[model samples]
Target: MFPDHTSTHADTAIAPGDDTEHHEGNPRPRAMTSTAEIDSTISHPGSVRINVKGAFIVDSTEQPATPANGNSTVNGSYHEGKDIRLPNHTAVVSHIAVDIGGSLAKLVYFSREAHSTEPGGRLNFHSFETDRIDDCIDFMRHLKDNQLALNGSKPKDLCIMATGGGAFKYHDKIKKALGVDVLREDEMACLIIGLDFFITEIPREVFTYSETEPMQFVEPQADIYPYMLVNIGSGVSILKVSGPKKYERVGGTSLGGGTLWGLLSLLTPANSFDDMLEMAAQGDNAKVDMLVGDIYGTDYNKIGLKSTAIASSFGKVFRMKREAEDEAEDNANVAQDHPQLDQKVHASSNNATSSSQPRGLNDMSSRFSASDVSRSLLYAISNNIGQIAYLHSHIHDLSHIYFGGSFIRGHPQTMNTLSYAIKFWSKGQKQAYFLRHEGYLGAVGAFLNRQPQNWGRRGSFEGDGAALEDRLRARTSEH
Candidate 1:
């Protein structure tokens, strides 16, 4: 949402099927039902396309109902025509890409249609909490009912792709709610794909580090060779990008945004992620987090890792003298309540975790006001991911890193933190990148999976009749 994090450069390829020569009508392959095959019964295009590389989820249901027909717009675009053949059989791609993170469940969908002249079909995107599984399911149903009400579309065909821990946990509810197919992608895979797609697609997508000056572009191609894909969503994961298609998820810690989100929710009165940012913006994390001096008593300056770097976030919560905390609280109250003290503090110009984010961020500003807390959590997760990625990259001798997933979207500070951490850890040897459309990777992958071999690559299309006749002529002559 903000400017790019300062840094540099990236690459990916996703093509389906074998060749450009397609059967007269068999182009977009509807993912065959579990038992069925490509044969006599189904012979039309499907409205789903996903690029496996990024597991990008793209839902394109071109509904033909315009002012000429009857249909309402959904998510700004109209479902043009579900079934051009039957006119009665409503065709729609109502897929849900639910990314259950440690803190929240990011559920995205397409539930309505647009008949207007504006391009890009009317597809809606929405989400809810990870804990509210039932509500998320209900929301999906509402989307389905809305689609069916507008036109009797098949709930069974609704595309449902899930990742993260809850994918397996809440699988049944999703299928039962929509009577559709549920696809499970590895959470790590989804994160990588999502990251790669977003960076390549969205030009302005970037995170900032070092005062936001000379912000780094979310460049996926300008790589040093093989690097790491550090996804800090609900949890944290690291994938070493080796080659165009070669990558290995080295290792990751479960301690990430989920830990931060859960802890903040319980320890403080923060309601939303934004609220947490607001509070952290002013709150003093040093009061809570454990510093290096608390552990070593001196600067262990042999390695650049500082003593003041949070040794254990919130460790001080247990060690602080209760009297000091009480007195500090009294002083803070006196300062704020007394106005004069507040004015003095303001005049001195001291900034804490409250509103303490790197410069050049959007209005959202990093995750909550406890920016120190947020920054600390980000460092813990991103640092771990980056170090692991560096290990894998060194082992495999690869040079590109793409970090993705819903977590990155909600926490740009985390992205910049990860980027800077990776850069610093590598001693300016490696870098990190972020994506714009963070969560659509798997959904787009699912969508592209349905197209014919020649469908994905541009300029490879064969016309319905004339192109077929010319190809047949060439084949017959050769025979």
Candidate 2:
């Protein structure tokens, strides 16, 4: 699945349900027999296929083991037990919000403990590939069924709040699978709303990455206006947020996460996005990228270019063409010398793919390892996005530029690259901050749309922003 490339930013509210609530002690859904089958294709790069059957088993015997937090663990996901509950299970309000993109589908729902009337619960997050919509639908159905079975508070009408392009595309499919109406919300509005909520509520949500030092959590700014939100998904969208419900789509780039994934699939054997990022962790981009030193035989001090600075991405591949050709010839010679071994190797490669990927290739380049290609691509994309973000920040006169989206996934190299780019471009006048719940921002924003009024507003929170900042600063130092 890929990101929704359609640029529609209109707010459309289709359906709204009663303020129904949910109580605890419901039957949770379990995976009866879930299995994924990988396609055995070597010619195609992104041709992975997954097949799942009989998912969302609701039997008590199939219930998963709960951790100390009293939250169920499915597929290694551990939700904390901070759920709220209403007394007597009297018409509980259970709201589920979804943000379906091209590549991934994110879900955020609220759950509370029994006999609790407060406006808080365990905000759970789950994600699956957008192509695998059935899997997500199954999970949502399981949650719905579980809620109905335990609470017995069936209402006359029920709908799941959804956002993103996938919401409109899969509207009918989700309705059929979940047996509930899908209320679509505006994608960009939901994203900004979500960012505002977490950055204010969660104590350890936003952090700044300063060079080689450990990440320091940034407290919520009291006058949190005029900040920029740069969400890097399949593509990038830069929103200049001035205040609540007041923002503008200042700029964006077509070259973003999708570009990186597309190029990486062509160069590396990594099938999944995360696997490609892992490869980059152990990679040396210097081997694949032509540096200033490589071009000038020394640092171009007159232009303030460091010797190690990348002159051009993937430029070394062409610059070192002679060596690459020699390596290719050597591999060809080895293959010819052992025809039987070469055939066997090709056969194995055809049948095997990455653990979570779909395609397999025996064509790992002899000139450069997968790690080198991965790192080069990573740097190339991150640096490009960072530079664009910095330029936008300068044009808009914005100081804080927070980067979020599924592409980041807490990747150190990616974050460091963006941080370094901002520092270099702004001359330390600005900093790049990342969110702990980066991928779920849109989904959370959609969920907040269903919550009580003023729930996501700045004035709703009662606290001294400056005092909170000082407290967080002290906490960071102690840690």
Candidate 3:
């Protein structure tokens, strides 16, 4: 069983029948004897070592093969291993931690070797849309049933850690579906924990993104304190972190991924979030947005505003619509005033309209390109988030800002806009950082919550292997 705690930061107590022994001056419990030699060098992101039959098995395989069930793959594969044991030698055959948001439900779980009681296994990451909650449940059920069949017995414990708003919203659904108590962790706490682990323990985890240089990995800072974490999901949350568990909700905005998604869904024919992003990638926001040049006919040098800078998102559409309406009205008046000339005027109008139609809001497909609309909204949202994040950082005087959440999805335009905003507002003083596994922060944090504190420090396994093995044996004796 996992450590029992009253709260996320509360002191944890070892569960009954646990093999670990507490040591004075050491936060993590140690095993009586070392049964395995842990290695920290793993060629994977967020890789951690766990004792497995006195051996360490690192998952070095590429992306897992997609399931035939048509479930989308995010980071980790589901069909990598059949029988994976939960860490810490508990009787829990299926262990999973989820971060369910307004849009996406991210999952982090361990998949171990088949029919093996080994602790070492692959840590897999997956995500599903919140609207499609059944798919996520089905995937979890698949993992549970597969483990049951391979182990030939029902698990004594089924551990499920959850976070985010959907953790409570979908708590009963998950518990009733999986038949296990859903352990809820604080969303903000999990986000900080997950982010701290990645920045400190995982190499090449944090990087800077910009249009000039797409991604440049940043080395872990020697002392990473007084930084800001801007998590952009359905909404935005800006946090000021002073230490590992010390943070405060500084500022945020409701204009985030949901705003873009909602606007795009209504304005365009995009079927999914990814589709909208694809449309954005192929779009030119200038076509839909009103720029400084559109307003001033040139850059406002006195105010330092570039001509190409966006003055208003979708601002030109209004004027274009008015012009189109006026032309249509005038044409109708002319046709009414002159009966014989009506056919000639109508034919000329048809030819002129066919030759060059004014870009307006009247025609859905012709005037407003889905790509242009998608790109404009994407820029609007990203720019707003970036500016707000910079403001929080400035007020708090935090130089380092890390951006996380599913909204990013490592999209080039989104990252570029965010990075540019930070640079422009801060005059190149403050930097915006991004994570490789940005979307799974909460999920990974929940996953780590099940393990001992500092269990995955520096990507090396530090625990009592003898105690783990003994616990594994004791659990097997019952079945």
Candidate 4:
């Protein structure tokens, strides 16, 4: 849960300094031009005018172009060398949208081009920890100020579209900080809309991950209906999406990303979620988890369970602790009965090197390394989510299941576990899909809410979508 009111003292700004260099030509005076003049200008090759709401002006003879590196150079300044590419021409920042979840706040905004043929500008993505709401507000304030300086006047329609629980919780703070109206949209609806845009419009946005072939792109299907969306955030929500803006939250679980995070915070030395993930990556879950082989001495072929399959998460640790406690108790009894022998043993143990001495129950980290604990907990959470998601898909008879939300973070182990769960549960009849920008779905959906409902199918908006797809594909190929 988020606090109703933000703290009086703002958190330190986490954004780095602007290091992007800028080059600008002489500013051209603004003069209104007739539609005929705009038509005639278009007739001439390489000449275009800035068209704003039927008003046209020749800003430059040549159209401004985005750099080949997919970095936007807007208003004489680059986007701090970020990979974000906006429309060719510079425009005002009219609107911003945010999806503030329990853990993270994702933001999406657009800089409309003043002199471009495209209808929609490129979307920029940014996020911050929920605890750092002040920092996020600062970033938004900077963006609004920058736009005000460029256009010399604020757009009357400027507003912040927000979703998630934090929208209502942080509404007053955001409005007071930025002096902009906050519009709250339904959280689930925004997620579906955002996902629909990416899967339908953006090329290579959706993909499948596996151990054999990681990040294999899945082309947008012609009939992408009735699919299951398992959004793993602080909690998990499984929805059955039948069409655009048509979805229902059928099932969910509390054992989600938050579960792993809370457990790791108490059990491991990981200071952050990424740190826990990194620790888990190097860990051997077999050390702390009970496997099928441990229980059966071989694979449970009757039920098709493999030898390496996890029998119980942290199951080995429980048994190990009990055995250690019983041994310690036995040692205490022997020491009470045979004091001389116990003294010799104690002296020998004290004389031995620290590495040679057995780790006690108090030193759980030494007995069961933090890495192994992290790995086991990660598997436990991922496996539980995957199984529940699969069950929902099965109940609805939906074959295509997509996992989204901040929890995945495109981490291989997380994806692999989820994918493997679906495969194991459905006997390879179902597959799990992922997204490149999985975490920003709600933010994007809220951004798109500013546009007309049918914008995706409109001619100009379709053209913009194609352009964005091309840009994203180009960036992907370069990497």
Q: TM-score for every candidate vs. truth?
A: 0.59, 0.68, 0.73, 0.71
Instruction: Judge candidate 4 at residue 348 and give its lDDT.
Output: 75
**Candidates 1 and 4 compared by lDDT, better number:** 4
The count of residue-pair clashes in candidate 3 stands at 2
Query: Can you write out model 2's per-residue Cα lDDT over 1-479, one digit (the tens) per residue?
Result: 11111101112110111121111112123222111111111111111100101111112321111123233334323232222121212224456788998887888764544465443224566777676788788888877876653333343234588999898999999888777868888899889878875564344467877546747877643346668999999899999997656789999999988898889889788866767887998999898899999889998998778998998999987746755556556666767788777667667765553322212123335568899999998999999999999999999999989998988877778888899899899989988889767887888778656532223223422345543222122112111
Q: Is candidate 3 or candidate 4 better by lDDT?
A: 3
Clashes of 1: 71
Q: Which runs in model 1 stand beyond 4 Å of their true positions?
A: 1-94, 101-103, 110-115, 122-124, 148-156, 206-210, 219-227, 243-246, 272-274, 287-319, 322-395, 410-412, 439-462, 465-479
As a whole number from 0 to 100, the lDDT of residue 159 in candidate 2 is: 55
Report clashes for each candidate as comma-separated counts: 71, 19, 2, 0
lDDT of 3 at 160: 78
Model 3's TM-score against the true structure: 0.73
Among the numbered candidates, top lDDT falls to 3
- Say which candidate scores most in TM-score: 3
In candidate 1, where is summed lDDT lowest over 10 consecutive residues?
1-10
lDDT minimum window of 10 residues, candidate 2: 46-55
* TM-score of decoy 4: 0.71
lDDT of all predictions, in order shown?
0.48, 0.64, 0.68, 0.67
What's the best-to-worst order under TM-score? 3, 4, 2, 1
